[model samples]
Target: MTADPSSGAAHDALAGSLKRTEIQRAPLSVAGREIVQVRTEIPPGVESGWHIHPGEEVGYIVAGTVEMRIAGRPTLLLQAGDGFLIPPRVPHNARDLGPGVGEMLSTYLVEVGQPLAAFTEPPDSASR
Candidate 1:
């Protein structure tokens, strides 16, 4: 409900270096819904803690490679321009894998009839 906390620190991007500016908290249906256009930047050798989401995920690697793991499965390395899709409620996580940094556009979709609230973050019990 509060404004999204800014990244504060700088990170690399597809076009050039960037700083986190905004994360538009979005709504999703039970099956899922796409996320708003919130930009992301990751620094070289840096990674985020594993986390989960309520919606199914589909993404395109806009720049660089990413190591993706669904349900804690073996990581699949994705390169720039590559795309992937994850089923709903399937625990998954990804980290920038290419040298320097990487970028991607992510989306989650929901089937007809599902409530939008179902599209949200994982249960409080998940890791960060």
Candidate 2:
């Protein structure tokens, strides 16, 4: 199934001023799965709130820099030409740390019909 840009967890996250442009969506050879590609523009200092995808996300930074925080892992500082992978259902947040907008291209391999992403509470929130 093709991703619907207007209705999904990804769109909900984008409400925080991130610009998301759908690049492509196509069924994968694997049954019950599809791949969705998106170009995301993050304004400087903005964070993509902790969230998880229904499947894995393979992403590449296209411009600027970002700090990637994934639960149970060391935070990563990434810049243009860098690439990263997020495991399925792993909550993570990406914050743009830059003087200009940060651009990223993400391709998700997800179960058909599932939302691209679902927001979650920060991993450390319960201790507060």
Candidate 3:
């Protein structure tokens, strides 16, 4: 296993300028694989622009609420204790629906050298 290679570049490219803390990160026991655990705080009404992950993302809502919309799915409103998944390379977006800030804990299974996420334009509905 090797050290995590994410260097905050993905967060810098996030749409709504959310704050992120790397809670736990380590390369998977398997060669060339890694798992990144991050806690993100989204300010009220802020939305992450469309983005895609290089790998699958599994997340848990920890505080407040969020509206998550994947390219081809209806918006899902998630509250604390809720869980969600974003499939690899699928474009999606999210917004904080909060009286205060919204928080979430997320884990990603990615290739060791891949960026955590990549910003992108929303996928056309017809092609989604």
Residues forming the 10-long window of minimal summed lDDT in candidate 3: 1-10
Report lDDT (CA) for all predictions.
0.52, 0.84, 0.80
| Per-residue lDDT of model 2, residues 21-117, tens digit only | 7778889999999998888889999988888988999999999999999888888999999999999999998889989999999999999888787
96 Cα displacement, candidate 3 (Å): 0.4
Order the numbered candidates by lDDT, best leading.
2, 3, 1
Model 1 scores worst on lDDT over the 10 consecutive residues at 9-18
lDDT of 2: 0.84
Candidate with the greatest lDDT versus the true structure: 2
Provide C-alpha RMSD values for all models, in order: 8.0, 3.3, 4.1
**66: Cα error in model 1, Å:** 1.0
How many clashes in each structure? 3, 0, 0
Which scores greater on TM-score, model 1 or model 3?
3
* Best candidate (score: TM-score): 2
TM-score of decoy 1: 0.57
What is the C-alpha lDDT profile of model 3 across 1-128, one tens digit per residue?
Answer: 12235754224366237877776678887788888888788999998778888788999999989999898787899999999999999999888988879999989897877777778888787233
Q: lDDT score, residue 7, model 3?
A: 51
